[model samples]
Target: MPKVPKWVADVLENVFSGFNRKVIVAEINHLHPFIKTIKFRGDLSGVNFKPGQAISIRVNETNFRNYTPSFWDSENGVFEVIFHLHGNGPGSSYIDGLELDDLVNIVLPRGLDLYKKEYEYHFFFGDETTIGLFKSLKQVIEENGQNYIGILELNEDTMHYELKTRYGLDIVSSSINKAQNAISFLQNLPDRVWELWQNGSFYLMGNGRSIQNFRKALKEKGVNSRNIRTQPYWVEGKIGL
Candidate 1:
């Protein structure tokens, strides 16, 4: 939900809390200055999670934020989510201040249909906010023995995060204009690389402007719009997306 009235949000929260699951924060790790990974333990026996799905948590009485789980073990009743604590608003502040054993009510995972197994090759393009989603997708793709390539725009300090190394995503510093930097990087790729990925599926998330620019570049390269999927996590000057 996007900035609803306080009374309306309260009513929705009451209804949502009926079926929402309460999870305890089990552990927290700071992967970078602004990146934190949190593990939550709870009874998730019947939860049906799909790659690229996000769980919504009420950050405040009138605001809710969605985050993608990086990994989960239903049998063990544990799941983990990586959060980029840009700290511009309540969601980041709430997540950053969470302490061990704190109870959090989270709505079940739900999101757009992002992953299509029918495609042999998958391409991902996004920034720090999309890391968790990419991580979840990478797990399923590797399990299916599918090929994938990804590029992420991250802060220079975050470039050394172990998760990025483990996921093997190409990282570009955010010091430059994000959308232009990403588009330039894609345009500079060799012809052979484009040949291999031209027919693949593309998943674009994170900044709305970046997705728009990247999508336009892909189309100009003769990639079909049908092959691209986009979910903007945020936009410049917007509180939530």
Candidate 2:
């Protein structure tokens, strides 16, 4: 839940406790100055998770935040989420202060229609907040022998290399005018690549304004609306989205 009244949040928490799972922090890896990966272990036998799904965790008495798991092993009851520590908000501060063995209650993964197996090729576009979602999708896409490519806007160019080397992803980066730059990159792709991806599924996520601009660019290029999936994690000057 976004920012709600404390009483309402408490009531909802009580009602949803049946679907909650208590997870203990197993590991924490600081991948960059602004990014970290957290692994949690819990009993998740009944929790069904699909690629691109997210779990909500309360960061404070009246606020909850959703995060996508970058990796999951249901049999081992383990999952990892990559967090982008931007700004000093409740979610960021809460995650930043997490320590080993810290216990947290997270709602079971919620399904989303972001993945389509029918498409042979998948395209992803977003910024730092999207890394986890893309990583989750990449696992399934690779297992199914499907192809995926993406672009991420990062604050530092070195992060591109780190992500590519660490995750084995076909991702490029843009450091300025992210949305417009990404559109230009896509539009200028070689004809063969363009043809192969034009009908493929596109998952646009992360910054809200960037998503809007990217979506418009895709539509103008004749991409089918049904082929584009968008989930804006946050917008400028907004608390949560």
Candidate 3:
């Protein structure tokens, strides 16, 4: 299929304007030196959002970006999205420039369904961009009486502390190594956790290269390809995925 051009995207945005929800920025929290969380309030009724799904936000006339909600409150019409301000791209600038009461347009959440009930245990891997998805999964896993373990590789040292203190996510853990060191981290998975790989559902996201490396390492460890799901949000030297 031919790639759609920017002009077509703009036209489609206008044609489907009715599907867009108007949201207000309710709050902002700088979780780390490189990460920020934005709270949004809008009419979210009638939308069935899955744990790992993401919503596309219209950042400007010709730019749209996908963001996974950290949590959703259908009754209250509120949710949160975490952003990694690693570059000066349009998405980063738009998120950074947001203030309380600022209005934005976002489409409904849709993406891969990672919260599988068939599996007894799940193992999640990602970087800063995976934080929101991790948060979404943790809640559903606990509610469903299932087990899950998250190993996130973040470049910022403060991310680990913030995820624990600010977010109170005890089930998810983190490493200080940059995303490039994901292979080494995956290779050194503790012997105690190796037993969980059997019959485990693996979810990998974030940096594309790192996700590929982790997926390969998991396969080398005898994990079935059917048990692994990956979504590469960004790639090295690439604008987006």
Candidate 4:
């Protein structure tokens, strides 16, 4: 759990900051008939943040989850996160019923120190759940004037994202239910994943099983475990009553 923010502490006993800081609204971008980029917006004005960090959201007392930043300018106080709807989760529920100007409560961004300088060619991979982190990193990498590689695994319907000129977007094909099929896609990696990592590092966000498989595969190919940084976007059996 994150330390409660200062504002909402008065009303919140288990959380920091008692007030609604983000005032979130959903930014729906329909890439195709099924692939939708639901960008969740929070108040980011004048806030300087490291790329690839995530904001923990408390949808209500009963629900709270973390979200990576979507492709948007963090410094300008505007942030976005994109996720494919799987139904029944609080995050999904709030996003489904979101209006243009509803205020949502959120915590400060937290995660691994993504702005790490050791990496050469930046690479990010995960399902639609990680779109926000991908988007946030894309902006930061491009803004810093560096070239990066990013592969997004999403349902064919939600394959829509128009990045700034400097960012490269590659969408992988998978079934509508991404949890299972996306894992298969990465397991095969179509082509060149092993060859591509010879000189740089990769940041991965995936399911527990997927990450386990990915680690095993990387080690078999002589890729150091330290060379791969991973965090699962959703683990099997985690979301529940």
lDDT tens digits, residue span 1-29, model 2? 46999999999889988989999999999
Model 2: which ten-residue window has the lowest total lDDT?
169-178
lDDT of 3: 0.77
* lDDT (10s digit) by residue, model 1, range 144-218: 999999889776767677655678887777644557877778899899988998899999999888888889999
TM-score comparison, 1 vs 3, better candidate: 1
Ranking 2 against 3 by lDDT, winner: 2
Alpha-carbon local distance difference test for all models: 0.86, 0.86, 0.77, 0.60
For residue 120, model 1's alpha carbon misses the true position, in angstroms, by 1.2
Colliding pairs, model 1: none
Candidate 2 displacement at residue 50 in angstroms: 0.4
Better of 1 and 3 by lDDT: 1
Output the TM-score of candidate 4: 0.72
Enumerate residue pairs that collide in model 3. none
Q: How much is the lDDT of residue 121 in candidate 1?
A: 92
Worst 10 residues of 1 by lDDT: 172-181
Deviating ranges (above 4 Å) for candidate 3: 1-6, 156-161, 164-180
Give the Å error, residue 136, model 1.
Answer: 0.3
Candidate 2 similarity to native, TM-score = 0.94
